[model samples]
Target: MTVKLRVTQLAQLEMAALGGIGLLLLAAFFFQLVQGELPCAFCNLIRVCFMLLGSGLLLNRIYGINPWNYVLSGIGALIGSMLSLLFMFAKALPTTKPTGSAILGLHMYTWTFMIFTAALFFCLVMATLYAQRDSLESPGHALDARPTWHKGVIALFVALVFANLVSAFLQNGFDHFMAGGQQHYRMLYDGDVMKP
Candidate 1:
């Protein structure tokens, strides 16, 4: 049997999902800073995917859930999964291991693939439920005032995403180029530091 979610419940779920994403991003940074694991280009791409997914949900909280939001988020997830898969199979650079770190015997890129796949599944489920609605009318709480916790969750999501972008810039420098095989962060002053 299919279950329907009320507008408020849906909003709460979106906020929760965004919070989860924010936390995951924070963890990534933790690994980067605490563990001294610099993110390669592929890792940065995965971070962008998470940010994109969070942005979609943030838009939903602000504008209400819509088909287009799901579409965009799903696309982001797909791209992330594809990149993850590519890195998983490709040979590692001479200076670095094939996988950076492992959690539960699976590498971070593998986890990224799983996360993207799960997000895509969630989008599919939500879209199907929305399609089964009887009326075309909105639930009408799109612009309503949200609880403080909801606002906090949204703020956290925004902060984490912005932090990811800044971290990427610091790691990759201002150059438009990205090196997936890079083993360490590249500083702007490091001339010819592209060697892996």
Candidate 2:
């Protein structure tokens, strides 16, 4: 007997979480490039977490691996969200000493604190959903008809990734792009830096 499911609880959630994160990453990068805000190592790490978590959710949709997919998303969300929060605290703590150029009269840490706070919130939401999610029903319940917002988010994510890719390649020349250089950006961030 062959059973089919489309809009299972987990799948719906994966879509929503991925959409939110995707929109955020896109918005963040565009804001950075347009506003001339630079991403410190920590910011970039958080970005990577968004990308990984987004990817994991996407993979879940296609692969239906269930446990691994949700687990990966949850763990990534937990770790990445926490990492962003810690960076926020570290940056905020040093403000008492006072230093560095303020962008638009605001310190970089100020920007990071806002970003991390939002990311943490989303990560928490995704993690909780993942934990409670047990099964996936067919996608027909809600997704079959296709909601307008869902489509918008998917389009936005594609746009964000495409923009990020092009901007990344052009700025860094495809290698050391985000490092404010042009040789080793694609090599992935160093692990030591990820640890607190």
Clash counts per candidate, in order, are 0, 11
Candidate models: Cα lDDT each:
0.77, 0.56
Candidate 2: segments with Cα more than 4 A from true spot: 1-13, 63-65, 95-135, 138-149, 174-196
Cα error, candidate 1, residue 16 (Å): 1.8
**Model 1's TM-score against the true structure:** 0.82
lDDT of each residue in 98-194, candidate 2, tens digit only: 2234667775445545554554565556556545546543332343455676567666666776766565554444443243212233334444442
For each of the candidates, the C-alpha root-mean-square deviation to the true structure, in angstroms, is 3.7, 8.4
Q: What residue pairs clash in candidate 1, if any at all?
A: none
The candidate maximizing lDDT is 1
lDDT score, candidate 1: 0.77
